[model samples]
Target: MTGSPEAQTSQTAEKLPLPIRLIDGLSGLSAALAAAGLVLLALNVFLDVLGRTFLHRAIPGTIDMTINWWMPMLALLAFGYTEKMQDHIKVTVLLDSLPIGLRRAIEGVFSLLAAVLLMFLAYYTWVDAARSAKIGETTSSSPPVMIWPFKFVAVAGVIVLSLQLLATAWRNFSGRLPREIDFDVDEAAL
Candidate 1:
């Protein structure tokens, strides 16, 4: 609360309710896993190509691993990060022109709807993951790798996203949501 909005947001996020902080920490961990997955994926592709071209023997299960595991980790794990950062694309022309109250109402409603949808997604994905684990489902690889873990990742990602959406909805309705930075507003008025 002592620093700029961005700094305050980062600080306050850490001090949020325990559940929020827990989910936030999990999101951070997911992001880290995504980063590591990216590195491993790159190395895997490189090694697979090299082995295939020169050694005439590709890395076993590279395609399946990339498609089934690495790609999901890379893509799905960033849900919370993107939501927290508000990095998702938004068509703001209409919102920007609206009255502040109306804009907040719209944002809050949308956020709530998003939260509901993500909650459903999280529930269904968790159930799917559990079913997969129970059935000992495996990827369609030569040596079929277990795939339930990736389904759990999807569940985690959606859960984090749902929490973030709920937080956004609360902030929006409460008029505590941070506004987009407008560096030129003051200067333009002057």
Candidate 2:
């Protein structure tokens, strides 16, 4: 009636409740920004390498930027997108044998548990970010990039990831999200 739990896509996204849609929007936005961060990171690395090879000098704070900024941005920011796409590795061997209703219920319970755990992670991450920001942290590179601002990136990423987990829990609870996740299926089916 609602979702087949067989396929979840943007089309189904449109049918989601407002709160879920809003969360999805935020998740999508964070993911899009993460994508941009990835592009920027690649370009930054490329330029740094080129400068080192041809100009005989590496970019002043390239290492610091990569470690402090780009890597976190790329990794943390896309977490929600990964969850939303259900792209993470999952072991469904045991789940496959259960009845559809039972499977959904089990999945829903696990999603809730995972979401709760992520909430704790987000909280601790926020505390760390706040401490970093309060200290006005900076990398010890020649250019001295500010590390404090980028710390918030971690907070945002964790928050979005937790939210995405909550959304997933809700979907699973509603029994509207999935039939089976067959990793062995043909790629063309996807």
Candidate 3:
């Protein structure tokens, strides 16, 4: 005998194409960027340690370059990628206890809010980046690196995250996405 309607519903999750593929591709790109950023950060750390410990002279602006520039860039570049991979935190206490339909509704609302917030962030970051570029903002330390590039990363990440959120919302509203799409343990475990 077949199980209940809810069981049946669980068995057949409609899969949508195109948007999912696009977001997945973008997420892969974000992961690549994050890997590159980590490599750069590691190299910077290695150089700093080597110079300070053996040579007894730190690289000028190494601290400033990493903290003020590379850190922000890494964070911004990874935002969309992390979101795409569903690595963001959430208050799942309520969501877990709720029925599937109720959970979907709440997810829809949350996705909408995230989309709006990310879009706003993208807009303002772009403005800030433009202003920084125009004013020729640079690190105060020796071997100055322009600050506008980091700002651009902020803008780009937000825009990409916004696009991903929109796609998520659309999939949810259409019932193409499962209530626990973001909570799939296989992907989350990695």
Candidate 4:
């Protein structure tokens, strides 16, 4: 019995193995972390407001915790996952007008640039984390929690984003990515 072309393609895709699947899974985790961080931020704000309005006492260190810690984590963690899903905002007026080959070439160049930027970010953040860890850096707020963890999170997120950018570049090089005007659109629209 012979398989259909679609089935053959599906099997070939499946044969690409578990690491890409794991990377995709990690992207999902990053997204979940970002969502959780947002929820936490909102909750902190709500609690602070309640405390200030009704209880006549603001939540101590809430601003420090949410702003200094949660927001950075949220933004960093969301970066790679959002890019992986092609959910990042784009002004595609120019890109959309370009020929497929030219558009892909442009995308490849941009992906390489993004990967380099992310690598630099990861390197600097790792150094910052190391310095903070060595010096035992702590927030100047009431609770005075250690700040190195947040820096480490930033480094991890940047590394993940860098990997995703490299993956995208590889996909583009191999002609795997669809020749679509907008990445968010369905493949049929390409």
Candidate 5:
């Protein structure tokens, strides 16, 4: 059998269509940002714990900072990466049992549906981000943190996911997907 979808995708990564390529590039950047956010989140939590436990004081604004800033960054930054990787949860039992042509037709229809929904989501999110920026929305913290940047980040992430979904739909329509190629375990070796 072939390797997982992720492996198959990576093998032909460079040959992906333009929309998929753009999504992959943006996903790579978002993955890096998410990694940094993870590191910062860990440090922040560690420091807060240390201060509360030994110093008899909690780090000021730690919760506020995490909830207002780091949480959004960590949560939304990996959207495109996960989509590009095809690592998201999917129910494939029925699809796998179906005949190839039928399965592909179903997948294509579902992909288009997902793309349309994601497009609406991205549009609404961007509108909200714009509104937040216009009003200078802030969290209800001691020194209330401006929330528009985080909202914009969310918009960016959703847009990337929407683009990726559209790419997937196009791939299905064009019959360029479901490439179950086995690149490992050479027959010659046998």
Candidate 6:
């Protein structure tokens, strides 16, 4: 993303190990799906409003669909991509006062710890998802809508998030992770 196509192909980024590349791809996929879901969710709500206003009839399952399907798809899948982009909110005033080496070390350790904790979370969520799948979990709309698939989406999100965290931990420990660039935008300029 930082360079032209030819530059990137010739750069060290493309040489990252296969697992790292795969995790990056997974994160990208999650982001893409989340974006697509956002579009669809907006369209769905628009249609629901249009139908009700024009025909005096509401979409039967629109509310359920929004709550069960689109919400989880958007929320759960965003974590890894955000983390990979180093876009998570940070209050670094205290860390900024620390020696660079110690700060990096602390960040690295916490990332590693978080990754481990999320692995356990992913496993537990998978177990619950499997149970939901086995039971054919669904919403109570007039026509039952399967809701279990989105449970797996949550699990995938967690797994990808943890993997990215592990990768971050590695970069942090090795001092290869660049400090995230901060951009100050003037609200009036927009």
lDDT string for model 4 (1-190, tens) is 2588677655645754466556656777887888898998999899999999999999888877886778987999888787766667877767866777777778878999999988998899899999998998888877776677778888878887887777667666665642223434356865
Q: For candidate 6, what is the TM-score?
A: 0.85
Runs off by more than 4 Å, candidate 4: 1-17, 92-94, 178-190
Local accuracy of candidate 2 as per-residue lDDT tens digits, 110-145: 888888898898889889889988888898777789
Location of the lowest summed lDDT over 10 successive residues in candidate 6: 177-186
Model 3, 1-190: lDDT tens digits are: 2887677544543344667667756756876786787888889989999999999988787777788667876887777666654667776866766776777777878888989998887898899999998999998767886777778877777777887777667666666653336442345555
| lDDT (tens digit, per residue) of candidate 1 on 1-190 | 3678779877766556676567557777878888988999999999999999999999988988898788998988887777666677877766766777788789889999999998988888888999998998897768888787788888877887788777777767766553453322355565
Instruction: Give the clashing residue pairs of candidate 2, or none.
Output: 5-177, 5-178, 5-179
Per-residue lDDT, model 2, residue 96, is: 65
Local distance difference test, per candidate? Answer: 0.79, 0.82, 0.73, 0.76, 0.76, 0.83
List runs of model 3 lying over 4 Å from the truth: 1-15, 174-190
TM-score of each: 0.82, 0.85, 0.78, 0.78, 0.79, 0.85
By TM-score, highest first, what's the ranking? 2, 6, 1, 5, 3, 4
Residue 73, candidate 2: Cα error in Å is 0.9
Candidate 1, residue 77: CA error in Å? 0.8
Write one digit per residue (lDDT tens) for candidate 5, span 1-190: 2798687667777677666777668888987898888899899999999999999988877887788778888878887677665667877757765666666678778877887898898899999999999999988777677788888888877777777676666666666653541324456967
The per-residue C-alpha lDDT of model 2 at residue 127 equals 90
Task: Judging by lDDT against the true structure, name the best candidate.
Answer: 6
* Clash pairs for candidate 4: none
